[model samples]
Target: MNSETTYLTDLAAVLWPCGGLLGPGDRGMRRRVRRDRGNQYLPVPSAHNPRVILPAYNRSAATRGITSFAQGHSLRERARTLLLTGAFATGMAPLLLRDRLYVGAGPGIEHALTAALDRDLSIAIHVGPPRANRKPVLLLLTPGGRTIGYAKVAVNDLTSRLVRAETRALRHLAGTPLRDVTVPRLLYEGEWNGHPLLVQEALPVGEQTDRPTRRQLLRCVTQITAVAGVRELRLSTSPYRHSLEERIVALGARPEAAPLRAALRRLPDVRVPFGAWHGDLTRWNIASTARRAFVWDWERLCLDAPAGFDALHYDLNECVQAGVHPGVHQWLDSGSRLLRDPLMSGTGLRPHTVSTVMALYLIDLATRYLHDRQAESGGRLAAVDDWLLPALEGLQERAAHEAAGPA
Candidate 1:
């Protein structure tokens, strides 16, 4: 079995120790597993069919689970969802065609789930693309097929930290007045079979529309930043910079250390506004509604981050995903300009030089990649040597050349 198969098998053992996963024609028939709803589970996107695993108990319930699981974020997402919906509608789901990845759930999951929520429900697990932050995300559905809430199971130390952080963030933001952004309500924060589990009330996400305007995006960022009031400070003395320095020091002999140190020395001390950021603000993590922008995934939320970080992150990630790798020049030129009008015009705040914020963002990002040991876990951006380090070095060279004018 491959890594994915291994992960699924291990997870199955935790969820159903007595009633384990089974393949086609496999013997040793544990009779008890067949009776306790163990036959209700299905493994998805396996050798039989590379599709999201949805609950296959009934057509209506399966359809609802599929639609909820696959939010129409892009054309590809929508197409896949439609195809799967059709498959379920016709009773031709891949699991029905073959028994390649069949799972049996014993009373363990139901007992823990019911004890946690005080209600019995069915579950559909979606393991997203393999990345450093990936974890098993569960959609809690009623017996009739309505998605009631969502749960995340942290399978490792990194994921466990993230799960706990999100819980804390939601609790902090709870009852806090957010103008146009809605955060998920924390329903339960506890452990499930030695793994940290977080259950949250699901947000009412709608179909995709045109991307939110720059004004709208910035407005949302502004509100998120104000959750903890923005502060003005020079980059040299700010807590944010201090934290980055500490991370570099902790990294010690890591290959990224020297380049990061050189880059830090390049930044000029300037006063800029610092505030909170959603940390992983991207297209996939946010949804649009007629009234407000619904954002989730608060595992990386930080209060002392630089202003304009979210806007930069949102735009930069879009560029990166489109195969347009941006270096320091793009960050200083268009990126800094992108923040000025949308973020500065009416707030009575000092205009942030896009370069300072951009440089700080780059450094902070590199620091996080190293701190989280993402490269070891196969994170796509973990190889900072290819993009981030070069950008930082370019920034350092430019700063040095500019300081020695008329050479």
Candidate 2:
């Protein structure tokens, strides 16, 4: 054996006086000993450290010498060394094994969740397995046994404060019509493991399918616009009105930012009436059953936003993923028609104005997506410069042309 191995064996012998034969089972005994001494020992692989034979011989020697040490300080020191060495070995072993490791949350998860939901008069039940980022979801069974889906937001030490602020924003919005407007109903709320938990009504099964309908998308956009507008009345704080120019600037696109900013500056300040709105309206977040449409995942809902922002986001998302359904086009056309009509146009805002806003929004989204993709595909930003510049100019030209026409 090498000197290091010989030294380790000698130390094991000193720790384990009653040396017979060390085998696989002895590792567990060593682990127990380490734990008893307030040390942690991660599990090791079986190939290099075979589960059946090698550990037994090592443990036999370790136990022999270890029992001879009656001094508390000595035992503690020895235990600490063994634990540290074992941990190092285990860490290095993974380099050789290359197997994926899945570490589960310890037992405290159940207690934390149960305690938080105890006062709701609902029976808290575990739903799915724990997900990434320490976020585990639970289903709250009401007194009537109705299941409500609740998400446990995972906030690590780094993001705890930010998450708390976000949770406050979410709770405030939950009180408004916009809260459940596009998502499942929020029944109860609390915090667990430094993360927030929100119990909401379960969306109907199969409501979300692979394909989303056109009317559904349009209705979602309308709802989001209405709800977002409602923010103007309830609270002064708004999360929806971010400057596109500032956002693009932070993304390091000064060249593209110039023209886009100028184009935005030229557009008429057309205001469309808004109401309660879902700030994030994507196809995956919305579902529809035969009789009712349901939107879920309200983490991004905001009280105030442009009327066309939701439509723009949805259309752009669809375009990036692939082509959208024909139904979506029909829906947009219908919305355009409604906006053009004079009788229904004067409600809160002008429909024609919103349509124009939506068109411009779509163009901006398409340009950004194309630009980002071009960069990601190992091509220089300047390579796509030819195509992207014209696209932006065309977008501005089209928007100007549409805006000048009769409402």
Candidate 3:
């Protein structure tokens, strides 16, 4: 027994830098593990460490991976050492989850989330940005592997202010009808290390099927954005107009861009059916269950927006990302049609003004993210340019044709 103990200590000296990959007795055991996992990481849980997900076991190899690190590491490096070594003490997968990969918080966020757990039972925290709110969300789990809530870690003073709004918005919605739609409930809100943290209800989501139809989408928009006694106004420039203008400025002045920009600037300000707008409305932020859409992510929620804008924003963003083909005209047509349909919506829009409102709104929605794409270079920018510019030209041509009065 003494010899076995001594062997572990000596092995630790040699292998600690190479991602310990073992506990005291796990050297031989880990050696017997499959060597073909490549650089994939497993989220192993450790009672000794508070953090939910730890590096399970990394096989040292010639290729650069998690195992390749310098010696004489800092406090963080040492913690990582403990995580990798202490993690696999039993030579078994993390009991918390059956899946090999853990989709929870990364280091910066996990550190805060672990400290926030403040419990004795082992907690499993995974970074599920898609599940959290669609962009870098952290989730909490029970020792028995049940998801309790999500952690909303404040990224910065400026962004954290907006992050706090999510909880507030959910709290507001808690009392509302939501028609038949559902949204996440905020369980708690607290601060850690001067950063705000939110624990949100982690509701079950259904499997992804077909995209929500126009009728289904409008139903969702109406239910989620409904507010009583709000004055109806035609919001011509849209709640997103300023943001759209900002994004356009970022794109700089190009000749082809000039026409669309001019058209946008000339858009007549008109009253719209004003109401609540889920600014981040998208398929990723919505789930369909029991013939109704379940919406999440209230970070971008606001009280001021034209009716039909929410519906158009949701569908237009979908169309932009999906690159709806055959001239990208169908995307515009469908969104406009839904916006005008009184059956699917309570928002009243003028028949003569619908096309103009829709043209400007779709233009803004489609091109809003182009500046970022252009900066990234060789991303989907080319496709956006291809689809949007031609579509814009088509709108201009069609407008002129109508003005000419059927030849």
Winning candidate number (lDDT): 1
**Candidate 3 lDDT (Cα, 0 to 1):** 0.51
Query: What ranges in model 1 sit over 4 Å off?
Result: 25-37, 47-51, 71-74, 94-105, 208-210, 324-334, 345-352, 396-407
Which parts of model 3 have CA positions greater than 4 angstroms off?
1-135, 154-162, 191-196, 207-214, 228-230, 234-261, 268-271, 317-327, 363-386, 396-407
TM-score of 3: 0.60
For lDDT, candidate 1 versus 2, the one ahead is: 1
Q: 192, model 2: CA deviation in Å? A: 4.7
lDDT of all predictions:
0.72, 0.42, 0.51
**Which residue window of length 10 is worst by lDDT in model 2?**
49-58
lDDT of 3 by residue, 26-116 (tens): 3333343435221223432322222233344322210111222212135776576455443344444344323232222222333445565
Candidate order, TM-score descending: 1, 3, 2
lDDT of 2 by residue, 1-407 (tens): 44323322332232223232222334454465445442111123322221111111223222222221111234665675465345333544223322111112232333444565554323221111111121223344443444445444444442244334445545655554542233455555666544555556666644143334655555545655554333222111223223444555554654666665566556554444544445446665666654445666555454444454565565545543432344344445544554444432323445436544554454445344443443443332223344434544554554566657775
Residue lDDT tens for model 1, 275-316: 889999888787765568888889998988878888888877
lDDT pick, better of 2 and 3: 3
How would the candidate models be sorted by lDDT, starting from the highest? 1, 3, 2
- Model 3 / residue 68 / CA error / Å: 31
TM-score of each: 0.88, 0.50, 0.60
The true-structure Cα RMSD of candidate 3 reads: 12.7
